[model samples]
Target chain A: MNATQSLRQDVPEQGGRRPGGHGAAAPRPRPGADRDSAYWWEAVGEGRFLVQYCADCRTPRFPAREVCAVCLSLEWEWREGTGTGTVDGWTVTRRTFHPAFEAPYTVLRVALDDGPALYCWGCLVGADPDGLRRGRPVEAVFTDVGPDPADGGPTGGGAFTRVVDWRLRE
Target chain B: MAGTGLSGAAALAGVGATPLSRDSGVSTTALACRAILAALDDAGLGVGDVDGIATHRVGDSSPPWVVGPALGITDPAWHLDQFGGGGVSHAVIGQAALAVAAGVADVVVCYRAINARSEFRMGGQGRAPAGAFDLQYQAPYGLLAPVQHYAVPARAHMQAYGTTHEHLGAIAVRQRAHAAANPRALKRDPITLDDYLASPWISEPFRLLDCCLETDGACALVATSAERARDLRRPPVDIAAAAWAGGHSTYSPPAPGGLGDDLTTSSAARLAPRLYAMAGLGPDDVDVAELYDCFTWTVVVQLEDYGFCRKGEGGPFAASEALGIGGELPVNTHGGFLSEGYVHGINHVAEAVGQLRGDAGPRQVDGAEVALSTGQPGHILAGTSALLLTAGR
Candidate 1:
């Protein structure tokens, strides 16, 4: 069997953001929307992670597509989400893309339970031995993992601060 | 032609390229169509008879029907898009060959185009230790960027084989020399091993010269059967063997939790034997090689992994340009991806075709009969591909 097939059940997984809540601290210059992604970005600013719903099929879609990649239905709507999913794949970055961020953080592609696959590039864990398994429940959280002036954006203070973009929710 | 030992049926008949500039000034779709049409014209084939298209995985889209309609052809037999990402252009040609060989199609065209220069904004990004892959794994501990990734392996190899950085410089010098002769190469500056060593380091041991110049361009080739090629204006280069495979996927389940595939064994290891067997030859029997060299060390790794030499012998073997003209093997006579244009690995196959067809202008390998070309993506596990070509049927 291939490596993934051999992975046991009950292994913990996390993605989208971090494991805990950031309470409430919205930062400046929120990642502006581009290419039909305003709704998803706006909801994130409202402290609620959400995905677009194909109004035709009522299925969640990610990366904020104007059309449902699955059904190709143009009718669309927004849906609040718990942001839970299992880890599909991940990479550990030893350096940040910018100076304000730390290196060696995890980037994850998480499969959401609400029915859309999401790719998130941000810090995911503290230095832990627990492996990020293929299919474990995780919820979103924000964290202060960078030196950016946003006292509350994910990874802001360069500390292992956990904000709830995602967490291993039991 | 079953035991067709020593018959040279394939010759790269034509080679075409789009310009390499910061902003390519055209849509990727437009660039691909132009490159394909230009290659067909170069090979003396008209658009009406064209019926096949193959493209790179990371390349811009080229819908067969859309491209066929634009090129003014109808009902092209087969259209395929391969995604080994970078460095699989030459390997894709093998698929085109199968189409014609099996009578699925009579003519095949392969092409690649990328706006990395514009889309990724890669330039002026200092060649510092990027620790890109290791940023979360080892870069925070100081392992960084392409050079640093390569450096780790270089250091491990140094300890194992006593190889030095100077040995690696020899490869850079020879490739640039080939580039100096090709007017299309982005880097035409004359360089020597001394110039190689003197250039400042981007990361430990790798200097400015040890890297490939990323460009914005597209290249294409037209392949037809040897039987029909005789009637065409340009001779068709026969495809003896073509194959490719991936090394390790960084995001797969095998990486983070389990011990991944060994980095020492390359992507080529999976496909090389079948390719050689199909061509009825081995590495030693081949006349020339156009191994991919996105980085200087990639050439070394491929040389050993592809059975040119024993593992760890690559560094010393490279020092003499053993693959250049008058050397045991003449590799990358077109300067390869290192000094040549990096249309992924498409240019390598074009050069091989040129050498076998005796079309290479100055840097040609004298009377090359059997030419082997290959590409590998990652350092250890590669997305490896190979091609074997001869002059005629």
Candidate 2:
């Protein structure tokens, strides 16, 4: 299978276990997608990173909004991102608050390169956490998570839905 | 610099709080009533005199409707139950002040009661409800706690200004020293910088000591017209000014063309001038300050945003002797949320009132005249509120 296909087929094990055996993990909480953000989650399920742009002002925004904060325009459209960004800030979770997440995972705040000033948060994957620094260039990767029982059923078409993860750029 | 017309129109007559503790072993309603009654007694007012009630909460505490009648306030002229955390602590006071000034209510009591440790703990399970629209973006990645949300900006501040963990540790250590003298402080044991550094990391860049204690307690303040305040038992702390500002939500996208550079800056930067303009006071006039200390970094950022020091210099400013009781500008003299209990910033207001009224026994700043008390500094929610208070002559 192609790399993309293999990634698509990867479904997280029960309880959403991380690679390192810290212990038994709890099921990761599912994203509560509403009407505004349901489409974005669908795109992520297909391994595409999408950002919403004001149709009139052409300003990009995230976390789904009804009107443009700049121009107050109702017009907007979704555009795929370049999956590339710079690390604006980051933190290492030494203590886990949620049972689903294991300790020692790095969470990154990335300022996307495709948009003028967009930023997103995700767990760091396939990269050394120590290498993370301000302005470090990074790219996104898609990972499949469970058909969570908390979600009742699959959000996407299949049994798993994809979420964004980050890795340092070569 | 138009005045808010709220300057000196209302005065905080009294402030009261339950003893800060790990477990109160009572319902939130009981805690609220105890604080409200104490504040009324402090103000020399009867329960029948309270025509207004204002409070803010995050699905953790009792509301006005429940606490109002329990206190024998049958027909409140005005009531507010704002939904938020530390962001609205001062806004409730501001709203109550406006209500009294506008003649909508004669006596307004602002209180916050939370069993944050024993019940509805912050960063605990089910704290972020399923419908919290903003959590959709963050919770999936295990960014559910305030420490995680705040750590991002703490890291950003460290990166831009070369701020060190030692600088953050200095705040923790100093505040603990202050708490050592505060009888009501939860963590009164003095901590050294060595102790601060040795504390385990809750979120990297944020050691266990960098965060505030989650305690179970309640705090209340009484606001009335300046005339009524003079008749009260305790010396009034006039509400010289109140200002609240809301910026882009931290979880939402930054404004167009606005890079993450604004991350290091906070809503305090936008509202400080307005707060001062309303008060007709400058930073130099502030004899003592009770800034929100949800995290050590917040104190560092607000010290700069409030014009106490230059931007990017809060690190060194925080580490300096300026924060001590006898320093140029004593801050969080009641130990703040760092050393004192976190009653969701309302306790900070109580501490400020104590300083202004000369009721603070040992940790008080000598001859404090004007005080600045603030809510959350807007790092997490981009919403902040503050009050400028002057001692009644």
Candidate 3:
């Protein structure tokens, strides 16, 4: 699952088609940002996945936490992820409530070996929808989801300008 | 139940509901007031007689204070405003029962009113407030809405227990049959297993038929001392026990391994024993079940959690006729949130009250002496709650 050999082959090229669009145009809804989670988002923007690791207990928490559940230790560090994980479970949303999230996209619950089993959004590029199975290996991929370059320059219609998504490991 | 102090202490004296619909064409406030008034009337009480109130809301419903004023009760001796979807279903009523039992307040009315379908559908792209850890981690991945959130566990349950969509479909079909007899049900058309299987998938493991209705309506119940209820207009359903508790700490900065141990189980596992202990009963004593059916998978999970069946056996249990109206337990006799409507879980309480009083016309469980009603499966922050209603003492 290491992308070093592939020279970051898992990462999408700067200007490619963003996911969840069915040739329809809609602004994506961004994650609600606040002081606690801004650092996590910033790391994602830089193409690095970070999990809050408790210094005292050696436990890693996701969604960012102030105090460790196991140790109640306030001391923690943002550990860089290996960008590799296993699919604990997944769902292909055939219909959705958000217009920006086009239907028929698979959402995988990835159990990061080093982190929590969240990372709710998933990606399985070039794989059949039926191919999705628990325990399948996957690696993280970052995509710049901005105005399509072909739309005569930034119409500025999308959620996060860039997001850290995932893809199945070859 | 030696310590079942509240047993026969309070009773559900009245149950009332507005018409279930996709659109009520009225403000949630108006709907809440109307339901409250109707319940008061059913209880043979008026605005002046009401001394306490309680309600649960999901942002789409009006709060107790607003509804109290509209119903001509400006000042109440006891009142509670709870949050969360199905978790508060019976917890609010339990709180009210405690109030009445402790002599803090009497003549308490518990209600839940929502215009969910018409205004701010729960499935829509409504982001949680900032700093909510689960939303921050999940929203970026487009894991919005309860359907998607719930599907993850349903998938895990299937993978581990080999639970199939057919197992879940049977629940939908059976509940729809119950709804067919309920005139107030929004979707009363009887559906077959094939119809359930044929429904399009909203989220995998959850087809369109597996989801609860996006309902616009309100349901309310009146609670007072069993002594007071004897003189009321209707027969009383004694509040044998009402219990609520947290579980597994799944989504709250979840434990290291994610969702802790088993995904198929819920907080009900921890709650069922306590609830029955308070009522001095067990699963076998329950004549009817009104388990929350926010999604069919939830019902399946809860059946196992509450000791109706062994853990991995929920799929097969759901597939059997054991949950039908004439079957052993007769779950969700009013069709549940799946087919009847989603007034949170208050409707489940209403149905239990009806069955216990022998007021449920076609769907009533014969000689139902004990009914078990559940709130949402306890996983999310809302956790879980339940009540055991028995025929009056």
Candidate 4:
């Protein structure tokens, strides 16, 4: 298996659900999905990254909002991301804020190549931290996270939950 | 230039705080009462004279209603219990000044009482509260701490301007030197740039020394009309200007049709002109600056945004002797949040009052008359606030 595949396997895919359900590891913290972002999270679960585009102005936004900040348009539609971006900035977290994340992980702020300066943040896997710099090209990689038993997961149930991270472009 | 009609109409008569430390061994209520009482005493005013109280918190500290009754204020004419963090620190004081100037209240005390260290540590692990729309995007990736959130922009500034680690270390070293003369500062042991370089990284580009102390304390300020302030025991520091602005934050991407976020700049850029214009003063008139130093990069970016230096020059500006007590423009005369305890930027206001009052002693800038104090530069949280104060009414 490649490094990316191995790293993906390391994550608690079934939300810590084990075979026979005898010893389940603790579930990682799930995103607090609400009405505005439920659909986007649903798409993310299906291994598709979506960006919200205002119906009127055609302006794209991330971390979905109810109204278009530019045109005040309440109407919007989802456009799938190109799964490609450029690193605008990044940080190497030496301190652990969560048990699921270990020390020395690099978090990146990447500007989407498909959208108008829309930036998203995610963990940088399958890459060395030393090569990180502004404008470095990257591609999105999605990992499945099963329905969290604690809160039925972001999609509420029966959906393939996933999270997006990044890897340097080959 | 006439300001928003609130300029110079109200003045800060007194400033007080509990000794800042990692642990205060008291409830936030007790801390609030003590600080408020101390400020009232400093102003030579009693609880009977107070008709308004204002405070800001983030589900961690006492509110105005609880603190008001604790200080024997049963029915205040006006009170504001704002909900926020360092971003709204100056806004609370500004709201108090508005109450006093508009005659909605005779005497108003603005306070912030937080047990940040002993209780709700900012960088500590916790679930993101409901309605934090932005955290839904960041928290999943373990981007939970302010240090982590701030590191993104700090690195962006470095990449854009060639700002180096030495440039950031200079700020830590200078603030520590200033803290040496401040008896109230928490970390007073002098730290060299070498020491700062050797400090462990909490978030990359942010060494342990780059972050402010998570402190347990409360700070209070008394505001009254300029007429009432002139008769107070301490010199009246006129509230020359107060400005607050909100825009795209690191957590939220810049709007597609709006002004693109300049990662190198901060909300302070939008606030500086408004603040100076309201005060009818220019940046050159500022004798001492108590700019927010939540992290070393904040001070650097603010220096550029507040017109102390040109864009991309903040790193060089902070690295020079210009930030010293006798330099061209002394900054963080009370050691700032970096060395002085962090009451979440409220202490920066108190220190600004001290410098303008000529009561800062060894850290006091010579013949200082004007002071500029600010809240968080709006790296993480979008809201940012600032205040400009003059020595006398």
Candidate 5:
């Protein structure tokens, strides 16, 4: 067995950040919302994860590029994911770069089972650094990270910027 | 076609550096100009002799356009203003070789000067500009610094190779030992694996000891045609081979399509064979080397990528006594960016030149004839590069 496989656990595990109490700030840097990538963020707010596929060559890519490398086409479309993925790699951040995050959180790179593997970054709800292994099955769990909508105006839990997290599947 | 006539076409005639410190207390421009003058003087040339200039900038250092006139060279025949950081190090040197080989100009000077500690600390947690599409994907996830970006691949290497923290600590301890011999090294005291493990974790699997120093300094070198160099003062360190190869992009893990099956493989994987072929030599032929050490894992990765060991063997290879002065491959003889100062990777070039010239004093590799210097890899836009230098007539 490979080194990663040797560390694998057969039991299902929980991963992804739990919602903080009412007044917690977003614990990460905000993505740049420009013309090319606004649609991806919009999908995240609606509790969906999206990846870009080239309209001409039918090639899928992440973070949205201007032109398709294969067919040189400038056209593309956003496709919803299948929500199933495998943990291809991960890192447990013991130190927080942002104030919103507490110490010791896990970031996993999940290759979505959507046709070609579309790699997305997110927290694994309850996984520890030692417990993670490659090839672990996971499914998406979008979490509300924006300001609260109950306050009505630009207060807590805004609807525009929810984050896509993940949980280990049995 | 590897190396072809490019071998022995240009020579590094001189190398210079400002005293490394946490704060230089001077402007980056002044530091850059001072190092350039020192290099030119070491080459037994004046500002007028510098007909070509190549340097990299990140809105911090003085560009060649600005540095040239300040050095009294009003107009240079060749100039290159490379972008990004250590990943572009040897590629900038390769630019100087290209200029000299093509006869665009002679007496090309390559330099990198930054007030990295005082003005722009590399270790800070500020977000990078959303210039590349990959940053758009990574920034929102709190992957803020080079340490954070590299952690993804470092962890993959660990999982694939069984590389432990002790292995990473070995690299730190060995480089620190080399640094202790060199006076210019910033952090010279020895560190045990226990001390390394105890150092605070900047990122997962990466402790404070794993990261390189944030230094305020400048390093510069003069390159000219081999014929011209023979007439100069110091022994010419012939630019035997300089090759810049295409590598993976900045697209996050489960890399973009062209990166192939290995997330743990570095650009040096493809770059080293090409580099050695161009130099008409192999890994075993190198007498000394200066691999870029932006992080300790980088040293481990490059050790494998440069053909020093097998892919999964980097950690164990580093943990052995093989990387020290009397060992198989004496790496980072001037301590490396981890312990030496961070002048991007130009200090690697400077150290290589010093080794080739038999001027490294106590830390010099014995019979160090053929030297290798490599740049950081995996910059989607900048690519990566390596250089082979040899003692010349």
Candidate 6:
């Protein structure tokens, strides 16, 4: 009757490759950056993308959490990256139970060198579908759809409209 | 009967559900209400007679308060909410029975509904925004989605037992085949093991068809006192034995000694002996079963967990063709959550009631008096709750 076992199973491995990956590759949780995540959103507002990093460990953070998961460091700084990442895995959704995501949308899990693996909505910028493979290079392309006004800003109106929640650069 | 001012004297007098389907084109709220009203009506009780209600917490639905009044309940004397684990629903049902048995209320209804169609467009994850708690474990490795979370265990199950992917596919092959005959099922057409393997991969080891269909619907039951149940409209099916627990024998958080890691036992294995003792029957006594099938591999897991098959034998045991009609035991006659709609385990219970009542035309087990329904949500392991509802209890 250990009540703890009643909780959800499947605590993800901190990072890939088991033991060594735990050294520093703990993934940054989503909406990861604290109040400053507004910047990530603001950046998205301008067709630009950014991620938080531990000022100490230089580990990239995602989903914008308050503190760095790796060193438990609260100190973080925002930085620009090449919207580039590697595909770890992907799924093409055919049937949808929800309305927001139209079917056939591809959800990909990509990896950045210092950050933990990241899962996000992705669109292949320009490549043959047959060539898709794990570890293949990918770069994020601003949807150019612009920032969502409901997202604490103006409707599709921004210099760059940091659109990709998390996208590959190329 | 945990001595909470309630002596566990409750009994299941009635059960009901609307026609099961992927999309009724009805609001989930309406779906919930319909099931509640139908259960009440089946018990020869009116909505006003129910004092308490329990739901699986289908997303975006009104709370018990709003649901009760909308269904014409004047002032419910009892209202219960249970979630966070698939097994919690059965525990709550037993608790409601205890409540009614203790005279806390005359009738208590347990139900669940979901616009899963609109909420879980992807079975891998739901509409819930990522939280700090879950994100810590999930967002990394892109394991944020539940399907992938469950895949870990399924993979371990494969690795530990040498169970082949085709072995898992056998479950799908049998289940959907049965679902094809079930008039109320969503995917009534047949699917082959080849179809399952040929299906596109969804997070590896899991194919598009290996998952349960996203559905919108509801199911409910009216549990009353055994004495009062005899006088109800439909025959009152006595809940002979009901029990629920959170962990297995020698349990641990990460599953001590990797035994729990094998996916063979936990929550269910620990609960099986108690359930058999309570029901006064062995696994051999069950004539029909409706184990949860959120995933095909899960059915094999529960088959072993519930003691229907040995721990390491689930894959091979389930591989035998004896599961369907003309098999050793008829199972998932309602097509299970795989082919039938997923309303938590409520639909399984309703289908069990039908089998016991001999109302399941083509899918019915000839004199099915003993039925078992079990579940595990998000790896939240709460053991089994067995109901021995006989034609004569």
True contacts kept of 1: 0.00
Docking class of 3: acceptable
Best by DockQ: 2
Q: Which ten residues in a row have the lowest lDDT in candidate 4 chain B?
A: B251-260
Please, what are the lDDT tens digits per residue for candidate 3 over residues A1-170?
32122323433544355543322245444555456767777677667778788899887776676888878999999888787888877777777566655566666777777755444345444455576777888877766555423333231222235665667786
- Output candidate 1 Cα RMSD: 11.9
DockQ, candidate 6, vs. native dimer:
0.07
* Candidate 1 C-alpha lDDT tens digits along B1-393: 242322233334556778765567776667778888788888887777678887865424555556666777666788877765454666677677767767787877787766545553232133222222213223222223444445444544554566677877888888888888887787778787788888865544466777777667778888777777777776566667666565443322222222122334456666677777777778887788888776788787778877888888888888775767767898888887678767677878778878887777888777788888876545422355778876675
Candidate 3, B275-329: lDDT as tens digits: 8888898999999999999999998898898999998899999989989888998
lDDT (10s digit) by residue, model 4, range B40-125? 99999999999999999888888888889887898999999998888888999888888887789989999998888888888656
lDDT of 5 by residue, B329-376 (tens): 999998898898789899999999988889989998898999999988
Clashes of 5: 13
Evaluated on chain B only, candidate 6 has a TM-score of 0.89
Q: Alpha-carbon error at B222 in model 5, in Å?
A: 0.6
Q: True contacts preserved, each candidate? A: 0.00, 0.72, 0.54, 0.61, 0.46, 0.06
Question: Which scores better on lDDT, 4 or 5?
Answer: 4
Sum up the clashes in candidate 3: 2
For candidate 4, list the clashing residue pairs, or say none: none
Deviation (Å) of B101 in candidate 3:
2.5
Candidate 5 displacement at residue B346 in angstroms: 0.5
Query: Can you give the TM-score per candidate against the true fold?
Result: 0.66, 0.93, 0.90, 0.94, 0.89, 0.68
Q: Which residue pairs collide in model 3, if any?
A: A28-A158, A28-A159
Can you tell me which runs of candidate 4 are displaced by over 4 Å?
A1-26, A152-160, B1-4, B126-131, B251-260
lDDT per residue as tens, model 2, A11-48: 23222433212222655666777778888878887778
